[model samples]
Target: MYNQAMVIGKFYPPHAGHAHLVTTAAAQSGKVAVLVLGSRFESITVEERVKWLAAEFDDVDGVEIIGMRNDCPEDYHSDEIWKAQTELMRLALKSHGVTSIDAVFSSEEYGDRLAAVFGAEHVLVDPSRSAYPISGTLCREDLGASWPHIIAPARQEMATRIVVVGSESTGTTTLTKALTEHYRPRFPGIADVPEYGRQFTYEKFDTLRSVVPDAGIQDMVWTAEDFSVIGARQNEMENAAADVCPLVIADTDSLATTLWERYYLGEGSYGSYHAADVLPRRDLYLLTDHEGVAFEDDGWREGEHRRAEMTEWFKEALTAEGHSWILVTGDHDRRLKTAIETIDLIVAQRSGFTSPPWASRSSVARPALEGAAA
Candidate 1:
């Protein structure tokens, strides 16, 4: 039995396989030290990867997570390269007050060389990867295919949230559902977060009123505190959904709540809703235009006349925040097509993959939306 053992890896997003390797090492040693080497060019940041590791091993005793930002040598077989890399590893361990290592655990052939350098025993764990059957390369190539191997909560940053925001009866919910269905096959864990503000106003409050005649519920009379609660609840729901999926289709977000608070409760009254720090910025926003679309009176809609004005308010709010958004107009089919094409472009840009067929005819160029003013 080893007193101190160490494991090293890039842990690019740290999937279940990596977890198994670390946990196995911890079981054989009194204490297991993990070194997470990260590159500047990787999709996930070094800091974010470290947080995932800490969270994953929070309950496991004798597990220490350390992170380093360093790229691997260009020539792996060069003697000088190996010597320099080995020295760096020694320094990293020493910095953590771990001067002596009894064993080095790994799943790669390099485990032998690394252990030799420390004059420690080399312990290989699942070298063939038949046990966990996953790799960072597989995850980078296609996250959806490797979803089963990922830890759900650690995927929050991996999620691309596309929020549908607009005035009342502008088909935000319809478009949200359409987008969720369209991307379901490509992203199995895709989710749809329904509008929480509407649920609060139409459902929750109605229930309260039924229980008490004068439930202190005045129609269209909401305080800043009320809007704050709505904003907080909306954000909470979005986060919960994001934790489970790689892509979240939100019918509305706190940005919409900010607009509603300003429009109904007055401009400065929405001060409580300006706490954008707590809100998650969406990757894309599909602002449904009100032109040529007949307003269907949802029980909560203020009036048809306010639809255009409310749409403008949403645009101004989004523009003020420098959010990436595209104005989606026309009939249901056209609107859905535009949204899908835009989302495809976003996914392609993020993953460095080929765009879908609809992306070829995408309306707004990528630069224009990305460079929009705050």
Candidate 2:
């Protein structure tokens, strides 16, 4: 057993393999130090990688997490390059009050050279990767497929944000719930963001009615400031949901609220909301059409007369903002199928991994509009 052992990696969204290497080293040594090394060009930030690693080993004793910005050459075969990188790692360890290393643990052949540079024994774990059978390159290529191998939930590298938006009585809420249920079985980390605008409106119902008699329901006397607050809250809720899941289904986003503000309060009112800038960018938007759906007045609805018009407004607004959206026009079951298909495609594209067998089933096809903004 060694007194001090060290393991270093880019941890480009640390997965289970990285965890195994670190834990193995910790078990063999009195003190195990983990060094997260990355550059600005990497997909995920070094801070995020450190956070993920630290969170994973928080309860473990004698484990230290150290972060470093690496600026060395990418080619590891060069002897000069290896020596230079090892020197930098030595300096970093010394700065952290770690003077000497008894062992250097790694999953790569470079461990031998690195350890030799430090005059330490090389402890290689799973050099063939047969046990973990995963890599950072594989994870980056297809996040959905590599999701199960990811040790930390917070490090969902390619989390897909899907927003369900449409006019009132268009089954946005119902579809959102169904979609969440559908994906949860395959991706257990799936989550959904509730309609924050409706929540805010309902929570402040009595107060608004007291101020204005016609304030009950969606007829409340709201201003641009009120919409701004709602948009901000909605964004906050969406981000909270995204943190825990690889796929987040939002009932509605700030962009939908901006459309509502423009529809009721006119175009000038929406400029103040800044929905595009404030709201988190969604991977896909499912626009529910109000053509066949009967507009049921839930007291908050703007009546059945303007349902089609409002639906068109949503499409126009989404298009103007250069959002990737698909128009779903069908019954409840058909709408659900379309949503599932669209989301599966997005998951595949973003993660470079194919959808599961069940999610691969074909559904009603629709042409997706892409990049329409000015």
Candidate 3:
């Protein structure tokens, strides 16, 4: 086993090719050092990418992530980037008491990159299929297409990534992991949309409630606040796909937010919506009934019959908002199968696309380089 390995990349957005490098390194090296290239511009911040990768690879013991800031300006072109980066690796190796074990892994400019840092013995890896070289750039371009079929097959090699959000434990997390297994997909990029209710047990919940007219915060938490989070979250997920579909199969999303509005407020409170104000919208949205899954409160969820009201309200809400969504019932097994198929259907649409589909504008598009590109 390679005791120590180094992975270097800008990861402007970590796509499938990026995952292949890390997945291979984790398998080959006893420990992998990921030196992320830093940026001088104010666009996507370093902290955001670091956090996303951390969440994605939290379970891998072999991976050690580090960020290398680019202090030099764009005009300051020097072959020295290769030199300085290599020296950093050599120092890391020496400190670890590692003479050398396996090799350096990378996607872009692998020859000069590994040679500059590790030596001539650096092995070149083509993680993508021999014929098709899937790189970050390719994933970025394809994402705008929102093609699920081509994406689904490409992601088969990488670990499964899922974001579960909905009322109580409607198997959001359970189903995410289960699908990950049933699929045996690469999962270095999986993350659970933290039960936002729990995330703000003290802070955000209290803060929102203080201003919220209804103390029925428990019922509406998934909606009002979560919508803001979900939209922001999906935008981030766009950049993180690789070794996983750019698809973000949400457990619950704006549809639920609308239901929360209808349930807590009057029938007229729910309003029109769209995500990112773009076409070729979210791949899939799975809304579950409380019937299949029993509601258990860890002090987060509050409702007597969360079964039909929320589900019904959501159907109306989704239709009014003009988003393509499916309501899922039955036990976990049946619902899981539906979700899988639904995602497949969405992916298939991406394969054969004419013109981009029209989508309602949810909000203004923020500059991608602003804060988070995860």
Q: Which candidate's TM-score is highest? A: 1
Q: Please state every model's RMSD to the true fold in angstroms.
A: 8.8, 10.5, 16.2
Give the per-residue lDDT of model 2 (tens digit) for 3-102.
9999999887688789999999989999988988877656566787888788889988889988888767655657787677777788778889998899
Candidate with maximal lDDT = 1
Candidate 2 colliding pairs, count: 1
Worst 10 residues of 2 by lDDT: 365-374
**lDDT values of the candidates?**
0.77, 0.77, 0.51
List of clashing residue pairs for candidate 1: none
229-314 per-residue lDDT for model 1 (tens digits): 88888888888877766678899888788888887777778644654557774799999999978889755566588888888888
Q: Give the TM-score of candidate 3.
A: 0.41
Query: Looking at candidate 1, what is the lDDT of residue 69?
Result: 71
C-alpha lDDT (0 to 100) for residue 232 of candidate 1: 85
Question: Which tens-of-lDDT digit does each residue in 1-374 have in candidate 3?
Answer: 77677777655445445666787889877888776655655233456555556666778897877666644332114567556656655664556565664567754345444655455346566633332244443333444322221233233322222333355556666776565555445323343343332443556667777788576545344344444454444444443343244434434444454444455555654231343343123444565655768777667556646655655665665567675666667888897898788666554454322211221111212332111223
The per-residue C-alpha lDDT of model 3 at residue 355 equals 17
On TM-score, the stronger of 2 and 3 is 2
TM-scores of all predicted structures: 0.81, 0.62, 0.41
Which model, 1 or 2, shows the larger TM-score? 1
**Position 295, candidate 2: lDDT:** 78
